[model samples]
Target: MENSTVPETKKDVLKMVHKFKTTFQRLLSRENQNVIETDYEKCETNTDIEKKVFGTQKDWMNLFEDPSEDAKCNQFAKHIEDGLKEAREKHLKCEILIPCGLTMRIARDILIMSESEPCGVRGCSLIIHLQEKSNCTELVKLQYDPTTVSTFEIHLTLQEDTRHVVSVRKMMMQLTGCFKHSTYKSTPKMLCLAYKLEKQKLYRANC
Candidate 1:
């Protein structure tokens, strides 16, 4: 299969995860100007599993404070809440398209990447498919270029002066802001954000 094609099956998905891990690790060290410990144990274990066992391991140690000043989880939560409150007052609609099979994973990724304390995104990506029994047609798109490859684009639209568009833009900016600072030193806060995300997996499992 061509590398450009995204995998849909479990086996192919596992392959993609391995590939992404290699690329992401290289990017992490080079971009952050700091070395992120690789999950060598995972690499070994993953090799032992059957191709059908495509799911990844649950490692809580990964979510640690990098070197940032604030808690990434909190920052992400705030980002989501603030964006939604701003959009709600103006009645704007928002939508986000994350990687396939990576909805929660991407959310966790955002929490770590934001590296800000007390963040949430409930209202930011809420899609209004139907409003007052009417269909909405006015829409804008936001895309996050992860792996330096953009595949998903979220379309959002609003009908009134509710400043919905502005909110969407704000959320997108926050989510994508870290890429420009890839070369900066990792802060303690950044590591903590990563840690929280890994720990939260237990809580998220039931949801």
Candidate 2:
């Protein structure tokens, strides 16, 4: 009777151990199954910190996202407008590179004059450089002045079909009228006003 009881006890202990082991394994498997997998990537050339962190293949994006291509394009335009504002603050003189996305024959605006004439004078001139992405570093100059503002717009509209448009507008400068005649640097004021108007316009347009 003693030997029989000993065997029964050993069997019971072994069964309990096996059951505990199975339960532990099941728990581990379930936890592993619920764990989410994620991946991320970036451009080969981009060195910006934001680019590094969220450049590609993100498991999560911002809380907000645009659902449509037109929305994305409009966002891009807004970004460009913001960048121009910063450029104006720095008094940065740079060319305006028109992207290929613009439709042909869209009227563009500019002030131009000849180099020989003073900027405020009637015959003053300004130069514009047009180039495509391939030749971005090599700017093709387009000369203009206050008198030819409309003509330049027409030329730009017509050239859209033939060539990529690049804007050579600087951060801020005057070309004609009483504003040009004033000796005071008016780039900041102009930039601020433009930014305010654009912000309102774009916000309403998007709305």
Candidate 3:
């Protein structure tokens, strides 16, 4: 009886050790997984910080460079040139419009027009070269189709004179009307406005 009892106790001890080993392995795996997740989070945070710091490095470097007569204009032209290239690659007609500066009312009107359209009509696209109050240029793309337009809106304060505001609003209304007409006719038309250049010429003539 004593001999049999000893063997049974040995078996129980072995079983206990095996259970402990399995538990330890599972806990270790869970700890490793947690560590991996924490490291990934840290990596993502660092990447975002790096992007914020380095994204506009060219603009920052330009501060020390000698300024040219057409440096800003050239930069704006380059952005437009690139936009045109992209449009060509996509086999879509592109129109470039300049509203002088984006205003809240103009933006609201654009949003309303865009939301009124349908979706997935691969007809034409719009490239907006927006010049901000700070003289910074931004490229905005809008799908100009019968079905749908992009809903992205850039918020900006109205800083232009009353006359300028009225002109811009008129231009927007005309463009919106064009969109509506195209939708009714099922024929999308490319909208183009060189308003800024024309306005500049008028100013020069007045001077």
Q: Highest lDDT, which number? A: 3
Q: 41-83 in candidate 3: lDDT tens per residue?
A: 2233333532333233332222212254125334433444555
lDDT of 1 at 92: 39
- What is the overall TM-score of model 1 with all chains considered together? 0.23
Residue 112, candidate 3: how far off, in angstroms?
27
Residue 173 in model 2: lDDT: 31
Candidate 2 lDDT over residue span 70-132, tens digit each: 343344334334444444344334322232222110111111111112231122122212222
Please give each candidate's TM-score. 0.23, 0.20, 0.18
Candidate 3 clashes between residue pairs 3 or more apart in a chain or in different chains: 117-147, 118-147, 118-148, 119-147
Give the Cα-based TM-score of candidate 2 against the true structure: 0.20
Candidate 3 all-Cα RMSD: 28.2
Best by TM-score: 1
Give the per-residue lDDT of model 1 (tens digit) for 19-82. 5754564455334322122222234332343222334333221223342312444444344344
Which has the higher TM-score value, candidate number 2 or candidate number 3? 2
Number of backbone-clashing residue pairs for each candidate, in the order shown: 35, 14, 4
* Residue-level lDDT for 205 in candidate 2: 17
> How many angstroms is residue 12 displaced in model 2 relative to the true structure, after the best TM-score fit?
82
